[model samples]
Target: MLAESIVIIGVNHKTAPVAVREKLAFSGDCAGPLLTLMDIDGCRECCFLSTCNRVEVIFVASDPAVAAVAVRGFLFAKSGLGDAEAQQYSYLYQGKEAVAHLYNVAASLDSMVVGEPQILGQLKQAYRDAVEQKTTGVILNRLLHKSFSVAKRVRTETNIGGSAVSISYAAVQLAKKIFGSLQDKAVLLVGAGEMAELAAEHLVRQGIGRVIVANRTLERAAKLARKFNGTAVGLAELTTQLAEVDILVSSTGATDLILRKDEVKPLMRQRKNRPLFLIDIAVPRDLDPEINDLDNVYLYDIDDLKNVVDVNKAEREKEALRAEGIVAEEVVKFGLWLEGMELAPTITAIRQKANAIREVEVAKTLGIMKSLTENERRSVEMLANAIVNKLLHEPMIFLKNSTPHDNPQLKLAFIRQMFGLDKESPEQQPPRENV
Candidate 1:
């Protein structure tokens, strides 16, 4: 069974620390990784998904164990970690487990903040990239498409997403806690990417007094700022703007820290030692960890947002249980489809055997009745075919209706024996050409 070897191997926030996850996170397009995975010995079809909190490779492999080892090595190649260490930090799910895991991801039930909707879009983009690169085939195409539909079913049927709290939303909730009310607070967003946009959206909803977006690209920053009717500035003016804004959200893609403690210490004096709330949601961490040490300055990284998320998770957890049930139902449906696929060859073999027997009998009868009219001979052949179909129809239905409790291999073996399909003696069987 091709789907029996379907596997997902990677690290997420639950299994690996942010420091480790950041090392394996693929930044740009997925073309490079997809091609590399296809180059591996047993990898057949694959999709590469890298997000801020997790990096996963979902693939079908002819040799699962060997391919899994190679994939884990590839993922941790840039992390300077050996296979043992990488294996320690990573997780692997195979077969039906892999299908269920993907569905959970699509439904956001496995997210750092369960029910966050962003992961679904990210998964969809990864799938599209895999499709464009021709890295996905029939199995993955069906599996991934099913995952999307399952996610939609969960969203439509449950209120999981309705009460969802994202990392950005959690960050904003923390800011509101520290400042008491956002109505009088000015926020300085250090990056204008999706995370920053999410934070800004939540802040505006909280009725924050002002919003300031700062980015490496002024045009992009200005674009996002305009959406919120806020102000935009370049990265250089970060320290300058720190004096005016009470809350700062940094989610840039910088490889190094964009704001150091030394750079921010003097700014506190300029702001008259006012309390500053800094949220660093970037994976590599755009803000310095030491910045938290400064007087009247509070800093929270991505992991800190988890604590805030946990506070309001009870309702979402209940909704998540409902979503999990939906995922389980979809998983079983897909499993049945895969099992039916496994039955296809057996079904074909049975039909061929029945046709072969009918053909040999019809040929012998026609040979015996040489004086019969051509129309009469055709009628005899048609009658033989009709009898074969009628005899096999019930058996075909029984095969197709295989249940989870039924051992498919046993059922197939029984049918093969019952029909004498296992007999291969030349004297007992018609020649290939004659049949």
Candidate 2:
């Protein structure tokens, strides 16, 4: 069987800032073309995972060596970086290393704030995209399904996700600072997406007085509002809602500033000198930075929220260790599965050879026994089949039970030679790992 390998080439919060990650992020429309391009370059099975904090290409390849170089080259091209610069920000993992890295990512141990839940959903979406593109094959399919199971185990068995460790959670903490207690504060959520919804949900749990959801689409805002027992408002209503809201959380997808100095200056006066707490978790920032200079108006962007998360992260460290153990266990189990899979072709070849020999011998015996009835011929063939099964049973068991780590190719060759199945038949080999 041709050796197959899994490779992970990525840049995450640890390796690169959000700026670099955002540059590499692939939209749903771009993923198909990007993966198809990789396929054309000999990627066997691949998936692209791009989230707010990371961008990674996890793929199976025929040659790990070649794939590593190809992946780095593609990333550099995508990032518009020279070789040295790209290497400084990117990370590469091969074989078992790649598996362990993915396991950690899926389990959220690799998140900026460990145990944050959003990354898992993002990864699942990336997998779905790969599936839709028809780029994922059996090996990746099994790997991902197993990763999902591992993530579930980690979530249930450990307290990793119990703490508030996301930037959105930090935004909630900031809200508490503005009013001293969130239970009596009216909040306005400036977006209806996951981050905004997460922020709103956290505020609700803290016993907020009221929540208002605003978005580009009224229907989406309405959905979020209904989910939280809040009021829904169109984006156009944000200015009017500003006066009524004591706390504002913004996590919009706009390319530019949504709340400018000019618009917010009047809203502050309209509030009659009341304090306004604004949290902007958006990439480009929904709220203008200049608004922070206003009287009794406090503004925190995504970076400021990270400071709050930093204080909470220590609580999750011990739980993260437990989650790490789960990830390690899953990685080993997956490694064993991959090993057994790699040996499958040799097993198939041996079985096919054994069956062919039995057939040839059985036919010869049947030809010599011309006087025998059809029923007798059938009995002879059945005996041949039983004999073949008995003869091959122990060898099959040995192949399955043996560890595939110490020179698997040598072991496979030995088995093929012993069974007289060493003929060059590509089709009889195990499925290709590298495309």
Candidate 3:
């Protein structure tokens, strides 16, 4: 039942370009509000995951068809795309397909760059956000927990994660070429954004010393600093800090340059010609392009990092094939589990119906044998119940293993015919019929 309760609607790098994906990106901070806007009446649980390569919503809905439509409509409205464009670039998966897609995403098989490690962390953050918002229920809770475990297992058991991979690590490698050794190197991080945090973590892990975070918002800067045990400073203080810092990594959302050549040129004079490594990971570029021309200052943008990432991409694809086999095996196992869950309710209903019929027949017979002792009537009822259970046990076992994919309509038809229940029960019937 939990497995059948899931629905997923999404657009990814495979389906759309960066320009389209950027429009759809949830940006994490505002996902709670966006989820609320998209929440349909029957949707009991929801989680939104948006990254550079993909934007997907996972939810539990009482009516998958209706909820899928609502989710699609929401995406279209949010992105200002027409229904035709949305349908062309988006996909909807329900039940087992949705679960498999999530597992593959968590395992990194669905990533733009295969075996990229960032997706697992992003998925975890999305799940955590949903949990904090109380939008995730038992079904999503179990599903996400399992996804984490599966990702960990895939990483540890296979050579996928060990292979040359990751855009962030590649960025660090490019930085190393400019600065031979990062040990005791002072780095200034220019944004409190997620990519800046990730780059800061990588730099810290590489034994960089004296990490300073500078942001327009000092609070956000301080938060990022606290995370890596670094110091926080205001953006206005960047010029004073620049002369002291060896590396500068900027990834801000500002519409304009946070660091211009005129600003850093004065600081370069005060630095006594110590080399400053600048890695501009931002899309709009936080640092001025002119900074690259200054003496003893090295600048590398996202395009530079992409070159090394492209080489690793080929190597990662080789390892990903092996990882893909592992994912396929796990997918089959999860699918079997899901199929078993779908059969549970039908099996339960059949057993209950059989027991009720047996009870009614026994009660009718007992009314005729009113002269008999009370103990005799009780014994007969017990025997009748046992006989009915024994008769239906084998069929119940068979149905439990049967899957909807194998015979989609047969199972429902067989259950209905056997129980003498209507094809559509009154509770499930139209409102007009009830009226």
Candidate 4:
């Protein structure tokens, strides 16, 4: 049988909003059962990756067009989305395009915030989960490993991740501009949101002296606080915590201002003119814009962080061009391998056809000439084998080096036709033992 084509079906941050991506996301416990349900003859292998920004299902299938539809339907059932809703957000890619998309994703070029370092880890975990579930076979095993190498090459060969490109990372960069280093600073994380968590992670990595996590729900704050060895507080206690911290980062779902100028003015006075740095990463603006004018206080909103991200994005886009070239090269190389795989059996069939003919002809000749010496018979057999090998040499080399674009399947069909190899039963051309 021929090697399967790859198919990818899913929704990402670009194709769908967070609401849609969340609806499609699969947890580890759900992956095993889903893999079992998706198990079918057409799709030979599968892997699923789900993160905050994207949910993707990849497969190696006999017919990618059919498999793409099936996979999309499977995800739709899992998402509980109506026909109209599902159709609006789903995206699909087939064959080499699907493979290239996976390569780009592993390399982080497909991320909402390009060059973010988290997606690769997520991909690795997904690959492991699929492996553990036995959802992946040889083809995907090779492809996923190649993706890892491709990601490493993109990282080493390009500066795509050299600077801070994410909004949370940009917040960290802005903080460094004022404090030189965050080692001795106290950070008050004012929400347990993803952005706040990411910003807090950066702060911990920067060696912040203390971290205080506050949220409307103290339990949510406590959960995030445990991850970074930080203290948890309720939003009601924000006034007292604000006075103790040097930096405040807020990214919440609340529609109203979480911190206003009136709320912060007294905190600044208690600090004896000490500077306070504020970052509000929420949509609808968590911090009052009026607070930017306060004495000894600096406030940077989401828009300011995005401006920093814009600059970093421009630089990363330059690096992405180089990475694209690398992906294209790898895609062609993998395509050639898949093509060469399909043509290999035909090469074996022809060689077996030639060898069988030689064996019959040689035996008949030796049997009729009974007086011939054993040494003469040996010479004849050797000459027959040499001739068969010489005749097959060029064709074997050509098949091994050929690609899918060479119309390899057509070439194989023609080879079988020309040599009358089609008359032989598949049992006659059963795989020859490797020498």
Candidate closest to the true structure, highest TM-score: 4
User: How do the residues 268-359 of candidate 3 rate in per-residue lDDT, one tens digit apiece?
Assistant: 77888888888898998778899899998888888877776777777667767777677677667666544534456567767778878887
lDDT of all predictions:
0.87, 0.80, 0.77, 0.81
Clashing pairs in 3: none
Decreasing TM-score order of the candidates = 4, 1, 2, 3
- What clash pairs does model 1 have? none
What lDDT score is found at residue 266 in candidate 4? 84
| Per-model root-mean-square deviation over C-alphas | 16.7, 14.5, 15.4, 13.0
- Assess candidate 1 and give its TM-score to the true structure: 0.55
Measured by lDDT, the strongest candidate is 1
Model 3: lDDT equals 0.77
Clashes per candidate, residues 3 or more apart or on different chains: 0, 3, 0, 0
Two-way lDDT contest, 1 vs 4, winner: 1
What's model 3's TM-score?
0.51
Reference-based TM-score, model 4: 0.58
lDDT by residue for model 4 (1-435), tens: 344477788788899887777766576564664466357557777898878788788887777767776677777776787766776898887778887999999999998867778899999998898888888876787789889888987887899998887787787877887887789899999889988888888888888889999998999999999999989999999889888898999888899988889988988889897788999888988899999999978999988888888889899999999999999998887776556445656777787789899999999988898887889989989998999899888877876676656745456655666777545233223256552
